[model samples]
Target: MEMVERYIYAVTQRLPQGQRIDIAEELRGLIEDMLEERNDGRPVENTDIERVLIELGSPAELAEEYRGTSRFLVGPDLFPAYLSVMKMVLIITVSAMGIIFAVETILTPMSILHHFVDLLISLFVTATQVFAWITAGFAAAQYFGVAPPGLSGGYNRKNWNPSELPPVPDKKKQIKRGDVLTGIIFSILLLVLVRFSNHLFGVLLFEDHHLEATIPFLNEEKLLELMPLIYLMVAIGIVKEISKLMAGRWTKNLAIANLVINGAIFLLAMFILRDQAILNPDFVQQLSDSWGISKQQEEYTTIKTVWKLSYNLALAAFVITLLIDTVTGFYKAFRK
Candidate 1:
């Protein structure tokens, strides 16, 4: 009986100070009652106490039951918030993964379907972690009794009085010129940083002619080879910057314009490259030798499938980005 009392005290010690003594006393009384009924007026022993405790259940589970109907980790009220954040995060992550898969399919000679499956798995794992972290923070806050700072204090309930509510602000007062200008400047700086890093790497490591000819379109001897890529990059960057500065129908229009410009450049490059048969002779011979196709048939069928896929991928990327930008623009416009 003494051993049982000590064990109960030890288990209940970690509970809040206000809850500890009452829970401990109740548990002690229940154990005593159980022992009394079991012994039939005989002396109680340690084994009897142990058997009773075991039948009652684990101390941790008992503590959890006692602490039930209270907010700790994710309570019923906050589950929606947890699920909403998780859903939004997963959507964003999948979209980003799709963009990544498109780029990888374009640049690499790997199987597109296989890479896409791998990307989906990777995105799911990443989204799980992100959602876990978000929910964990909320759980931690509820456990610690610390409400998130700067959010509404009162719950939205039925019979809530309008007089008790704070005055609503004018919608027109929300727009700030300085805030918009700051966002535009920050966005431009980020784009500039990316461009600068790419240019630096291009000049230093990729300047050599030996590495240049390995890529189909980057060969120096190929006239106007890089014009398409340059035009596409510049057009996309400008459209992104314009969208940030002024969102609405105009932003969607700009995105469409960028996509059209990039598509045109890609088509022009394909026409020129195909006419010159840049990937014809050597690529055909390699394919025939590897696949056991006859040499005469190789010339007719062996095309630069990888290079063509890359061009198509670039066009696809622009279209996808445009679609995302257009949707986001309309969402923000309405949200404002």
Candidate 2:
């Protein structure tokens, strides 16, 4: 009996607090009853107790049974209010994960696919955590008898059918004028910063030759020539922020559009660079010479090929990310 008590405690300890005591008490009574029935009129023994516990099955299984039925905010019931909240949370979490992956992919030499996979894993982890919290809250409410019957399980009311769920209110319609003014101000600031960054890089590279004098093949002037795209990126950012303040659906679409544009630019840049590298090995040789290095310093061909392949792979990843963003954005836009 004591051993059974210990086993039950070990198993139930993993469960939330609301039902732990009740479950433990019920299990204790069950084990005792089993032992008594097994022993009959004879004295209780270790073998009898073991048999009783075995008949009761594993402690883990028993704990699981006590967990009862699980429910999500969006189940067969399709409650509009609950589904709306869950959808919003999922969108926000996935978007944040995408942004994190994009920044990491841009700054690091990691493959785009690797970063994307990481993002998916991260989103899954976040979603699991959200689900766990919701389940725990529901369990606590049910155990304490605090939740109304309507919310405790799937909606069953004839008048409140899943197919007839009420339309979700557009919360963006409540935004005030101040929000628009703030967005405009941010847009202007972003544009100025992007333009200034391009000018600064241009001056440092072409006119001054400050940092470019130190590193070879890092053409700041060429990068500055790409500044129009950077400005476009700033405009996209402004649009995204404004859309988010106005409507979630619009925000998602804007984000996808921005990703598509950036991905396309990255792909074009990679293709041009790769073709140039292949067509003119002398270009690479010149870069080496400018850096006061010899081709024999390393396996020149192997190094150039590897670098080109890596660049191409990174570009491919951008395209894949853009595709994922577009699909997810579309899903969010129409899921309601």
lDDT (CA) for every model shown?
0.55, 0.56
For all predicted structures, in order, the TM-scores are 0.39, 0.33
Runs off by more than 4 Å, candidate 2: 71-204, 207-336
Model 2 C-alpha lDDT per residue in residues 277-299, reported as the tens digit of each score: 32233445654566566778775
lDDT of 2: 0.56
Displacement of residue 34 (Cα, Å) in model 2 is 0.9
Q: Give the TM-score of candidate 1.
A: 0.39
Off by over 4 Å in 1: 1-41, 45-71, 111-114, 117-121, 144-336
Q: After superposition, how far is residue 113 of candidate 2 from its true place, in Å?
A: 23
Look at candidate 2 and give me any clashing residue pairs. Answer: none
